[model samples]
Target: MKLSVWTYEGPPHVGALRVATAMKGLHYVLHAPQGDTYADLLFTMIERRNHRPPVTYTTFQARDLGSDTANLFKTACQNAYERFQPQAMIVGASCTAELIQDDPGGMAETMGLPIPVIPLDLPSYQRKENFGADETFFQITRALARPMDKTPQITCNLIGPTALGFRHRDDITEITALLSDLGISVNVCAPYGATPQDLTRLGAAHFNVLMYPETGEAACRWMERELNLPFTKTVPIGVGATHDFVKEVATLTGVEPTLDTARLRLPWYSASVDSTYLTGKRVFLFGDGTHVATAARIARDEMGFEVAGLGCYNREMARPIRALAREYGVEALITDDYLDVEQRIETLAPELILGTQMERHIGKRLGIPCAVISAPVHVQDFPARYSPQMGIEGANVIFDTWVHPLVMGLEEHLLHMFREDFEFHDDAGASHHGHKAKPRPDPEARQPVTADEHPGTVVWLDDAERELKKVPFFVRGKARRNTESFAAEKGLSQIGIDTLYEAKAHYAR
Candidate 1:
């Protein structure tokens, strides 16, 4: 019921089109304009799907906004149906099209087509990509659930299954392996291999497995209510979690699951111990709650790193995340306010910052080595082969990223201390940093900042940098202004160079 159902924790647009691209024998008639269709690039350039979103954009322009748009939409739909004899048709709209309220759902029903039609009411402004994904999957499941009947008891549907990240294929393989080992057969994985018949047989599965938190809840509930097919909420990420998941599934399915699948060739306990050099390495944490929670376990248990601070700009997902944060004895800083995150950086002073693309810039400015732990990851997250964050190899990846960033344990701490600007504080309670916390400023003593504080070379397109100054935070304004002023003094652009001089020199006094 929370808005998190529609809110995304990362780049809302990541790999969206990849879903459409992977699904053949499906036609997508987007109720969007020309520019909105560009989502196809995620597949063409990033995920590298051969075709685009199985789409036919309405191509409605500013001119068509006034005309019989319904007719235009009808034509597009008819043409699409003719061109692609799809098993199913997806009728969807982006943010702009939602305003027009083109009820394709009603129209598709009246058409009396041979196949099913899924109407996606994904309002871009109010929601995000992950939410759209969940809702769409939900609607599609319901759509495919028409004229439902009972099925075999052994099969099960896989919820939250989308082909997006580089590791998706491997993760699926791993899940299949573990489930197969438990004798719980997978019923459908849609758009990958599952047929319409397979989708119809979804209720036949004993239950559903939700791999990701983003798209699982709605479909799980619907299946539970309609088909009495219950589901598991655990996201099998780390070693301990995976082991726990295997046990749980074994109990649920009433099968004696052998560790033959997850327990591989290598000695698990001894090998994990082999990577103990990574323990206590100061690590910064930020990302979506789901991935962040998983990362924390991987950092502490698997990778052997000590997390300094955990924060996420994605506030919508902070609920399930807080427990995970408290486990590490740190309250997560949940805000889109980048400066606050920066302040957290100063406080935790982690040797390595594991975060999103935005943190790449912050880490560079702060002189900390970093690797992107979660999304909004660019093409770089995917290596030549499938480098997944699953199984033993995932543990290895964690070990390498956490360890390569710094030397083991206290050495990393001493390095950050020596290199960073460590100042004395009185309270010593802000965070892990032993520095004394600064006293709050008296309201009466506070004054409006003057030109003297604004001294800096104003860089072209420095609006964003300047925007950081107006943040209500007293500390952030000071730091951003100071950095800008320093750049101005050096004739570099970021902040205006010497606000006083720039003004006075322009005037004839």
Candidate 2:
């Protein structure tokens, strides 16, 4: 309802498009103006699909509003069904077009196409994208899924995961194989590779595996209430969580939990290099609730890192995230406003940031190291490689994805610190680049003001300010605050280089 340059989620109809595009035999007929059709570029360009999304927009112009927009939707719906011959279709209105009150769902029912046409009563003004995907998937499942006998072997549906999701394709591949290792078979994975025919057999599965709750939890809960099918709550993202997931699955299906974790290197790699300056490193996380929560566990338990801050953008999942934040002794941020998130990141000033592409830009502006961990990512996040965020191989991919930034950042910092050294510059120029490269501007000259820069009780002397700039940019904020606090406690109004070092030593204890 509010306007912003960047949004964590699009309008409701775009989420409906995600469900439509993820499946093989589902079509989305959106009643909207031509400007609303831009969502197609998301899946085609970002996801790099060969074909366009399976969407048919009415694309009603201003002139059409004077005429009959309702008839325009009817015509588009009929044309899409005939052209695509989809097993089922979802119809809805875009946020901008909702003002006209065309009633897409009711109009689609009047047409009575040959195939099943599910009208989505998505309130665009009241909800956002994730709600749209959840409601649409639930409607389709309720219409198609029938009470059937369970599969002879133990099987479960992989619920959630849609097109344009962060690593959804590979996550399904990884999780399916992990489940197979425990003598379990996957009956169907919905809204990703599933079809209308697949939904009919959802009841045949003994249980469900809810992968991404943002898009699948509604349907999974509905099945649990209606079909008497159980579902797993553990999302296997890290080493410890994956082990817990295996145990939960074993408890559900009566299968023994014997996971083969020989390929996992995160535990060993983290501990072996414990004394190499990574232990107790502070980290900030912001993304979806699922990823933020899972990454918090991994940061604390698997890696020797301190969770400096943790939060999510989705308000619907705020309660659990807040509970987890309390466990880590931090407040949960539950808003879609990017400015607020940026301000909070500046206030926390963590050494590393794990967040969306927006935070990546924020990190660069603040001269901090950041790793993309969740959705709303850029094209670069969708690498050509088979990098997943689940199972044993996913742990390896995560280790490399997360550690490379910090390690390379440290190297860059060292190079900048010793850029003017005679022996280091002479050896570095010849070996690394074959010649001396042009000297860049000083990093300290472009440093962002720390939290202590504002008018405050303690003032930094020129020498002390210069010394603080020598510290790494990511932790410079913390260093400044620590020195200021040390000064305030000692009743010192001014600070110098000696005070900075003395404060550092005092805090070290």
Candidate 3:
């Protein structure tokens, strides 16, 4: 594998850990090297769980390679079953351990443990984290779910919501409440709060509600084919989508749709005079397929924003995102490389970015505002507050999460615009207090990065640079690029105030 500073997805075994750790009575035994144990810190530290994930690692070192590493895996599996006494166990090998070719799944089967031992054939080199999670859940469901009679009342299994999912804990609460209001009861919520025994009861539900398709679609489709259970396709993220979701549920369960949106404030807030500035704002979206698609629709249709760019890092989602991008008349970017994502953001110069934690860092470096909208997020995204990304309340949370960054960015821009004022200057300290502000580095003192360092090739004169500063900070980068391209087309070597105004008027037409 190529080495890089960041990655969108980990190897498949980590996905297996996500499913195992999210459940109540399932354990994961990973055949990996000692260094591979670092993955446990992800759930324990980032997710801030009180207990570590239910994972047992073989942790074989270099010295043990000459000897039998397979024996180490067998020992770990036996110890895991004995110590934890889980209802079921899943076994797999990490990317590094895969080179040894110990065949973890075959070894797990021969052990003949009293409890069910489901072997996971997660190919680290060929597959990724989401695929691993999907396949693992599918295998578990296929092995444990039995044919049975449906419940008397209309019920569905919330077939997704794993550990470390983007706001999955709260999404479950929101969706479950919405379903309860529609005269439907939930039979079980799998892979999150479910047990291995709950898998057997999965068939008792009349149908399933597929929340995040990336992690749950495989299992849901399998159930539809094997158990004759139908699942919902709509993801209730925004006001419009939530309404549509309720109607879809009505069609499936024969219950009249009851949309209780009295608590939703997004529609009223969006049309208010105070929010007019947000209209026509350009936004870039990059994340998982489901979030990117849902956020794009919300941004354009619900929030009155322009879709400057749209993309996803997951290759599995390329086709849908591409089609959506085509609908918006922009090329879709489908790649895992962070550098490619960063370069595209620079070219687009969107006023705001809704993406993963990686895009947050990219935004900060490029002086743009960003909000986290998908997985591969930081610890801060997992707030203690009950913020969800689905249901009626979720629309309110989305309004706040996506808009706050732009609002704060505007405040910072105003501060920069009036920095020359004695009262609002950087050294003026807190406006409400008389205390002296801390000494800050002077921007002029540092070696200025040339405008030529960016995408364009045109030079800028001192007067033109001062004139360009008058443009709002949010659109300043785009203005500069546009002026440069205009100058280049006219065969001008250097840009002046006249040229800047001329380019602006030309583009305004």
Candidate 4:
């Protein structure tokens, strides 16, 4: 809960619903109105979940807002418990309900439900969905934990598992396979095959493998302090980190360490090749601190990109990330302000913008190519195939997202060879004409070339997809359409406005 300078770009609670539905058996009882329930679409469309998130909304209308709010909650809870009979239950409230101060946690505790009741305080006003996810998992695990003597031994809970995770299936498969080879058992995965009953078993596990930092740090620390369970501080998004994650888990579990030659080495080679081209590419990054930190490492160390900009909307875990950003000689942008983040993007003007869905809009408005590296994901990120961003597979995804956007990649070589008549410009200002080029045209001027002037002329979409335009905050559809139309007329592909921005500037008009 902190300052958020800019209004959020997407609809509220959409991604959270995507996650709730993605998990097969999870149930979420929301305490809000009908608009809040539109989140179901996130699963159906983006996450492609055929089944609904086990969620029930109080569906409180303004008419019933005062008369039966408490009764509505009780009925919702009873019906949810009766219908779903979830092993673990989450009593969560959205930003709207948080204002009324119902204290669902207090209600759930007072009701004395049979299952483990996790009261989650996810005030949309104060925090983002990622924080809710991490807290939700932690609350569930803690709700199910038992006293130490009764805890299971050598068993560990795999943390940071959530709905529609970037590459959850692959991450779990690799880690589980690795641990199984050493005869280690995963007691429970917070969101996978886990229940209130399995929670007590969490105390038995000797350690926790924190797959993602933003989501797992709290639970991992609680487990360590409360149950003496150790956690591995490994970010398993690349080849080396994957290896280290495995090794560290082995050490904590007292199991013999082994490696999968195919799984481990191929990605390292792929990343190396990717780095060869992406090296020194100006890149900017933002997300939850954990993923942002991982992206910064891969962009700078593995991919040879210059971190022209770095920032995270989450400040709770900003210290370590901030300290690391210093290596690039740039101060980490740690603020909850989206406008501030946009301002930073404008100032840094990296060749590529690496950030959330919000920054994707910022990058588009700035006319820069971008890849959504973390949350606030788009439908594109959920390609038909299972592409994970953790373990070896994650390295592969990173390689593609980073190198594919550049003109210096293998495609550029093929283009050069194909059109041997065309000349190459190696100079930094080749396209800019010594920085005197006019900034992108106004969004309002994006009219189609007149029919009288150019009758029957055909304009392809890419032709209109390159120029910068003012992106309206919170109106995603308008922003996207406006950008696509402008880029088409320029004959050049999109440009990120960030590349032109000098630091120490705010996002004013």
Candidate 5:
């Protein structure tokens, strides 16, 4: 695996922790070192979960590695089963423990536990968090699912949602309400609140609804192949997707779908004359595959934003992201490096950025506005409110989350017209938000360089810098860099207003 300061997803075993934490009576015995226990903070601190994750870590140190680490793992498993008394148990090893070649699954089996023991054979170096979650959920579902003698009903099992997901709890509620409105019943929702018995009844449902493509697709595909059950792979994030999702479910169940557009305020909000300014607003998107693709569709189709650039860090889902980028006539960035994503944002200079916490920092550095839309989230992303990113309510939330960062056309025009007025800034330290501005750097400490000060460097003329300030502050730095690069390419030593305009025209093409 590649080393990075920031990663969209953690190691595969962490994914198993997510599954164990999300379920009701499931426990995970992780054969890992003490350092690997840091993943617990992700759920407790970020998700604000009241209880600790349902995991028992071996936490073997260097001293234990020299001793009988295998026996330590067995003791941990026996203690976890006795203490938790879970209905089901999962056994796995972390990257460091895997090197020791101790079979954790086999040791757990020999313990003679009464409950079902699911073995997680995840290769930490070969896969990531999403893949691990998918494999674990698929294994659990396959092991517990039973053949039924009854006919199918107008019901479905919602698959692929778990703990620490981006607004997954509310998304499930929204989707459940939408289905209920159509007189459809939900048989089960797995890996979120389902028990071992709930998994056994999965075949009782008429079909399956694959909510998040990253974690649930594998399980749904397995069920379809084994049980001959049909499934829908639509993610209901935006207005159009929600509508399509409802229609698809209706078609699958042979029932007439009923949609109350008034319940979903996004269509009306987007059609309102006040929101006309949102048309053609440039947007940059980067996240996991599911949210990034959904956000791109919503930005371009519903909100009328020009998708300047879009990509994801989940390399396993690269093919679909590349297809999406091709649809927008842009190249997809498939990498786990946050620096590459930051460089792309600098090059795009979009008005609004929809991404994760890493992109939030990058946008702040570039003076751009951003809204967190995907996972690898911070505590703030899990707000203490009923905000969701799916179904009708989710559409309204998306409209507000994405639009609040941008300056309204009329407000911006007025600001530009009266920015020089003394009333705009008072000596009392009054500003737009009534906050005091920080002290500026001393000009004498770092003097500005003139064209004659440098021998071969391309310097910005006074008029050129002044004109560049007229551009949006978020993109001013990028504009200046681009103009200077263009001057250097043409072997020019000075960048005048004419040269700036030439560069702008060249980039505009």
Candidate 6:
């Protein structure tokens, strides 16, 4: 396996632990070494879970490896079942235990436990956290879902939400409220608050709504194949997406849903003259598959931002991300290395970054603003406030979350006008309290030349320079580069006010 100081995802077994912890009356028996137990801290410390994840690790040592590790796994399973007495149990092995070639699933089956024991055979070397979680949730559903011949009702099962997700708790509340408004009831929500018995009732719902594709797509597809239940894969993260989600649900249920447009504020916020400055603001996005795709849609359709870069670390879901990137005319960066993400951020030099905690760190170091839009999140992202990333309220949060970093239209105009004043000195730090002061580049060191700098190179006359200064400081470099390129292409060796206006018109056309 590749080694690094930090990782975007943990091993597969940790993913299983996340699922087990999220659900009620479920327990996980992990055949692992002592080191693997560190995953408990992720729930206790990072997620602030009151109870330790319902996981019982074998905690085998090097000395035990020479002996019958299989027996040790069986004993742990027996003890876990006797102690926790869960309604269901998940049996799996960690990275180190997998190398031992001991089949924990088979050993658990031999014990003849009364509860349903779902075997998770995840390849830690081949897959990651999201994939592992998906596999476990699918397997558990498959193992426990009973055959029901009941007629479909005006209800749906919400799939793929779990603990430690980015705003999942609040998103669930928002979606539930939206569905309730549409007169649709939720039959069940899996791997979040559902029990083992809840899987049997999945067929009662008219359709299924997948919140996150990474976790629920496979299970929903399985239900479709086995029980003939239709499912919607729409992620309701923006006004447009939420609208489409309601429409899709209506189409599936054959009920025309009337949307209360007044509940959504994104439409008015985006169209207001005060928000005109947000138009074409360059943005870079990198995270998991679901949030990255949702953020790209919100930035482009709802907020009017130019997506400079978009990608994810989950390779299993790369097809959709690549397709989205192609639509934006940018290449998708699909890699697990945070350094690769950092490099792309540097090359793009986006005005804002929408990404994970790692991206937040990268942006902080590079003097760029970033918002945590996906998992691998820090505690700060798990705010006490009811900040959601889905449904009507999600659109409002998205507008504020993405735009807070950008300078206001009036504020920026005033700053440019009073930049020379001592109180408004260019060296003065960012307007926000915690923001760093972005150092200004020396005029002499700038690549473009004025007539005073290089007699033979392309030159900007007095009026042209004055016009260029009116461009926002954040985008001045790009404006200068484009203008120079236009002059060079038109065979103009020197740039003047007339050439500048002509270039502007040419680009506008």
> Which candidate has the top score in lDDT?
3
Give the alpha carbon lDDT tens digit for every residue of 1-509 in model 6: 56898789988887788889889999999999988888667877887778888999999999998899999999999999999899999999999899998998888888999989999999999899998899999999889876576544488889999888888889889999899889898989888989888887888777889998887788989998987788897899888889899999998887887577676776676668877888888899999988999899888877888999999999987999999999999999999999999999887888889999999999877767788899999778778899998888888888788787775434665777676676565666454533566645434233566556666578877678877877765556656777888998988888898888888888778
- For residues 57-147, could you state the per-residue lDDT of candidate 2 as single tens digits? 9999998889999999999998998898999998988988899998998999998788888989888877888888888899999999887
Q: Which stretches of candidate 5 lie over 4 Å from their true place?
A: 149-153, 408-417, 425-428, 431-447, 451-462, 490-499, 505-509
- Each model's lDDT: 0.63, 0.87, 0.90, 0.66, 0.86, 0.85
Error in Å for residue 115 of model 2? 0.8
Q: Rank the candidates by lDDT, best first.
A: 3, 2, 5, 6, 4, 1
* Candidate 2, position 80, lDDT: 94
Candidate 5, residues 324-370: lDDT per residue as tens digits?
99999888998888999999998778888999999999988887889
Better of 1 and 2 by TM-score: 2
lDDT of 1 at 121: 66
TM-score rank order: 3, 5, 2, 6, 4, 1
- Assess candidate 3 and give its TM-score to the true structure: 0.93
Error of 2 at 497 (Å): 3.9
What's the true lDDT of residue 426 in model 1?
21
Which residue pairs of candidate 3 clash? none
Mark the 10 consecutive residues where model 3 has the least summed lDDT.
Answer: 440-449
Question: Model 1, which residues run further than 4 Å from truth?
Answer: 1-19, 146-153, 191-197, 261-277, 313-316, 336-343, 407-509
- Backbone N/Cα/C clashes per model: 17, 0, 0, 24, 0, 0
Query: How well is each residue in 62-118 modelled by candidate 3, as lDDT tens digits?
Result: 999999999999999999999999999999889999999999989998999999899
Among residues 3 or more apart in sequence or in different chains, the pairs in candidate 6 whose N, CA or C atoms overlap within 3 Å are none
Pairs that clash in candidate 5: none
Candidate 2 Cα lDDT to native: 0.87
Q: What TM-score against the true fold does each predicted structure earn?
A: 0.72, 0.91, 0.93, 0.73, 0.92, 0.84
The regions of model 3 sitting more than 4 angstroms off are 420-422, 425-430, 435-462, 481-495, 506-509
